[model samples]
Target: MNKLPYIFSLVVLLSTSFGPSSAQAQERRGWSPQAKGAVIGAGSGAVLGAVINKRNRAVGGVVGGVAGGAVGYGVGKHIDNKQKERARIAAANRAAAARNAEYRRSLARRNARQTVAPTRLQPAAMPGNSLVAGSAAMAYDAQGNPVPYASNAAYLPNDAYGDASHPYSTSEYRRKSW
Candidate 1:
């Protein structure tokens, strides 16, 4: 009977086409959490619905699948949002740390450049071989304390009034004037 062979072929085709495959068992690496949740929810809900409804299994499966898929997707989306927020906070903290480190290094370099070696200044080493009776240098030490260098020499007149070309002609520094 030709019908028998055709019937057998049809049965075989249906079974093979609808049966579970190895590809379905494997996890899809590219699927997002929400997509995975939706698929899993729909599949589980359909199975449960079919089992619970004996009379209209098709309608029950469809209804259950849609409801379950919506809930699963909502839960998965919430998880995704939380993960994103945590990642953002961590990135901000790391960026702040990097900036602070750079600031400290900049400060260290600036301090190193501004460092000065200690120099002993004496009245005899001054330009006029003496400091004014009560005047002091405007310089400070490392800790910002005043350093006083005193002498018994008489006070000199303002040096701003002197002429460069007539250093020896000024009354303050004329010949034999010390």
Candidate 2:
């Protein structure tokens, strides 16, 4: 009859101790090493304690559990840390690879640009009778066709009307009205 109470107490203690860990394991997406280690430790400790101390099962179980738990925690923590470090290194390598690929693509684009012939400005197609200063005053369309100036007066070197920098020019006087 005394052994019945002792057995019940042992069961209750074990259940209470493992309840939170079991609940956490279920909630997690995957089994963590720490949790696995703890469960294994606790179970092995209980079994070993029972075998070793047949007369005082509770004291033996408690002491064995504490020692096992500590060792398990240390081993599990070391493994978890190593895994995290490896993952970090892998991520860094991937990022470096992506950067190198981008750099290679940019280098290829630059090389392609260098290899192509540069587009030259085409001469203006002036009428045979018309006079132009030079190719310096000429502009072109996308199709390499000459674009005529809006007014020949604007291109006249000494024309008073084209001299915007002159003190009495219309541009300077007109802005006074604003």
Candidate 3:
């Protein structure tokens, strides 16, 4: 009947319209990570491109997306390499600085030893409050017996003019005459 033909025509129209959509879906199914990323980028680029241009919008978008992704990847890799190189240079500089500091310390020690005078060694018998070593029958006790003394003994100056009543009245400088 007439209804049968109309239904058949409607079926054909629906298939024609849906067939392409189904094919497009199949093409997108199970895409790899990079492919999916590229497709997404392309789609976004196409949208932007279309906004910017009335003609060749799809082609412009695809080109722009690919270029952007590639450039982004390259720039990222370049920055990573530069950062690694900078770190290596910084480490080398630190090591050199440490070595230089150590060298300076050693040189300073050597210079100090050379500039300062060494301690003098003398005979022990001359232990008369002096930095003399190896004294022979010197320093006598109350019984007049010689005794060995230390090499570096503290110097004790006898205050011949100081007394218990004038403990702080001692002066080593002579008074000037006017």
Candidate 4:
């Protein structure tokens, strides 16, 4: 009969201690390692203490539970901190990798632009021909095909050199004989 009351008290204590904590843990998401450790430590400590101290089980259980819970919490907290540090390092590496990839892409684009051949608007030189002051120069399109000079309109007045009455005529020199 005395043992029955002791058993009942133990059961009630365990239920009250762990039930609400477990429920709260579940509601928040899941049991953190610390919470899981604490629950396991407390239960195991109580069992061990009850077995060890036959005369005063309750006092032994309380002392054991506190000591076990403290150790469990420390270990759990250490593990959690290590995991968080690892996650932080992983995130930093990922960010650096992304930045490096972006920099490479931008570098490739700049190199591609620089390496492409530029389009020529005018010929560097004409084979077997010399440039004349009043003549339209040959030009080239992007495809290397011959095209009219962009300044051809400026040379159009030179065509009137053939007519003596033109303002740029050399008739006065012809009449001077020198």
User: What TM-score, over all chains together, does every model reach?
Assistant: 0.50, 0.52, 0.32, 0.51
Clashes of each: 0, 0, 4, 0
Whole-model Cα lDDT per candidate?
0.70, 0.67, 0.59, 0.69
In terms of lDDT, the poorest run of 10 residues in model 2 is: 169-178
lDDT of 1 by residue, 59-163 (tens): 788888888888788877888899899999999999999999999999999998996767544333344555354443543466656454333334433343466
lDDT of 4 by residue, 1-178 (tens): 7689779987998998677564554546777888877877777887788778889988888877887787778778888899899999999999999999999999999998865545565434443333345444565655677654424322333445557776657432222111
Kindly report which residue stretches of model 2 are placed more than 4 angstroms away from their true locations once superposed. Answer: 4-28, 115-178
TM-score, candidate number 1: 0.50
Q: Rank the candidates by lDDT, best first.
A: 1, 4, 2, 3
Candidate 3: where is the Cα deviation over 4 Å?
A: 1-62, 113-178
Flag the better candidate by lDDT, 2 or 4. 4
Which model is ahead, 1 or 2, in terms of TM-score? 2
| lDDT (C-alpha) at residue 37 in model 2 | 78
Off by over 4 Å in 4: 1-28, 116-178
lDDT of 2 by residue, 25-87 (tens): 454587678877776787788668767888988778877877777777777788899999999
Candidate 1 runs further than 4 Å off: 1-29, 116-178
Positional deviation of 55 in candidate 1, in angstroms? 2.0
Q: Each prediction's Cα RMSD?
A: 17.2, 15.9, 21.0, 20.4
RMSD of 4: 20.4
Q: Which residue pairs of candidate 3 clash? A: 124-134, 124-135, 125-135, 125-136
- Number of the predicted model whose lDDT against the real structure is largest: 1
